[model samples]
Target: RFGMLETVSEFAGEQLAAHGELEMVRGQHARYFLALGEAAAPHLRVAGQTAWMDRLEAEHPNLRAALAWLLAAREGEEAVRLAGALWWFWYIRGYPSEGQQWLSRTLASGGSSIARAAALVGAGWFALDQGDVTPGLAALEEAVALQRAAGDRQGIATALNWLGNAYVHERQYARAEQIHTEVLALRRQLDDQPGIAASLANLAGC
Candidate 1:
């Protein structure tokens, strides 16, 4: 949890630029945090949730710095990876607005289909949370399509789950039920107990 004052950080940045090492150093920093985010992603969903959340929270500023550097460098794929990994943290920690902005930027920059799909899931959820239905639905639908194309069953299930939630939010009960039913079937095949329970709850709500 070490940090420098704003002025000190700015001064260090200037020095790095003067030394012509800024890009290299920033790239390294971004990659390091990218790995950290990816490692924490699963933990955030289940076991060690609180511990992982706290660790991520402590590194939030550094994570933002890494993402900013990646975006500034036009490293689209890395940016997408980092944003995709961290979106859940932003969502649960109540930073959906910021998360949406980062995801939007990464998406616009473009990346691999699978990575982009993951980012879309995050973007879609944030948009829905912010009450923007059209873009939200569009993003989620696109993500599901991409995941299907890639044969990423888990990814498809996750995207479908969110898509179902979006339909529920829009009060499209029948559509939501259909989507959740599909998700439930997928979860059962995967033997994901948590996902099965969630899908059942979603179906019940629908």
Candidate 2:
């Protein structure tokens, strides 16, 4: 959690740029935080969730800096990856609006299909949370199509689960039920017990 004084940090940054190393250094920094975010992502969903959340919270500033650099550099794919990894953190930390903005900007910048699909899932959920149904539904639908084309079964199931929730939000119970049923089947096929439980719960709600 160490950090330099603002003046010192600025001076060092200037020196790096003077030496033609700023871009390289920034890239490394962004990649490091991206790895950190991805590593913490799984932990945030399961055991020791609070601990991982705290860890991310402590690194939040650095994570933002990394994302900002990535976006400024036009590293669309890397930016998407970083934002996607941090989406859950933003959601749980009550920063859905900010998360949505970052996701939207990164998506607009373009990325690989898989990366973009993952970011779309996050963006869609944020949009839905904010009651923007049309764009949210569109994002999730596109995510599903992209994930399906990429043969990412897990991604498809995840996106579908969110889509089902969106349908429920819109009071389209029949469509929600259909989507949840498909999610249940997919979870069973993947032997994802947690996902299976979620799908069942969603179906029950529908």
Candidate 3:
């Protein structure tokens, strides 16, 4: 019995070492994901949404993994960038809570204002979905202003969309309609059919 116990303890030590080695490998794997995420983010900008949904689904695990690693490495800016980039994917994939949590942490970790604004919009969207209306609306409003100052029309439109939705939830139908109307006009100017359809649908909801 003593010898068997000794053998078991030795096996446990081996398993522990294997786990440690796997973690070392995970760090390398995470770096690969970081590169892939950066490359993929730009493409999502022109998403037909469904096609990118499948792509983002496949990469979802790696996205989470990369987020964990970057945050752990104190690369908050990079983490913010990646998380902000995936906000749309996370929403479409029904992983808004995960997206919200990632953005919140990265934003708090202190990145560039642009990144922070992006994260705020992401977080605001999920927060509104989760019934956190007031703060969510505030975040969305602030993000829209920030993005506007930076001349990021797309970003401003993104935050405005969220704010419009939040106003709908709050039963501020007139406000919601006005916001979505502006979004619709912006999308038309950008020749974004998908965005135009989205804004029109939201406007209809109001």
**lDDT (0 to 1) per candidate:** 0.91, 0.90, 0.79
- lDDT by residue for model 2 (62-81), tens: 99989999999999999998
Query: Which one is best on TM-score?
Result: 2
TM-score of 3: 0.72
The Cα RMSD of model 3 versus the native structure comes to 7.2
Clashing pairs in 2: none
Per-residue lDDT value at 195 in model 1:
94
Off by over 4 Å in 1: 5-15
Total residue pair clashes for candidate 1: 0
| Runs of candidate 3 exceeding 4 Å displacement | 1-31, 38-51
Candidate 1: worst-modelled 10 consecutive residues by lDDT? 1-10
Q: TM-score for every candidate vs. truth?
A: 0.91, 0.94, 0.72
Q: Report residue 95 deviation for candidate 3 (angstroms).
A: 3.3
Q: Whole-model lDDT for model 2 versus the true structure?
A: 0.90
**Candidate 2 runs further than 4 Å off:** none
Q: 1-206 in candidate 1: lDDT tens per residue?
A: 43789899899989999999988987888899999999998788887799999999999999999989888898999899889999999999988889999999989987899889889999998888888889999999999999999998899999899899999999999999999999999999999999999898899999
Candidate 3 per-residue lDDT over residues 26-136, each given as its tens digit: 566666766666666666656475676676688777678778878887878888888878887788778877788888888877787788787888788788888888788
* Residue 206 C-alpha lDDT in model 1: 93
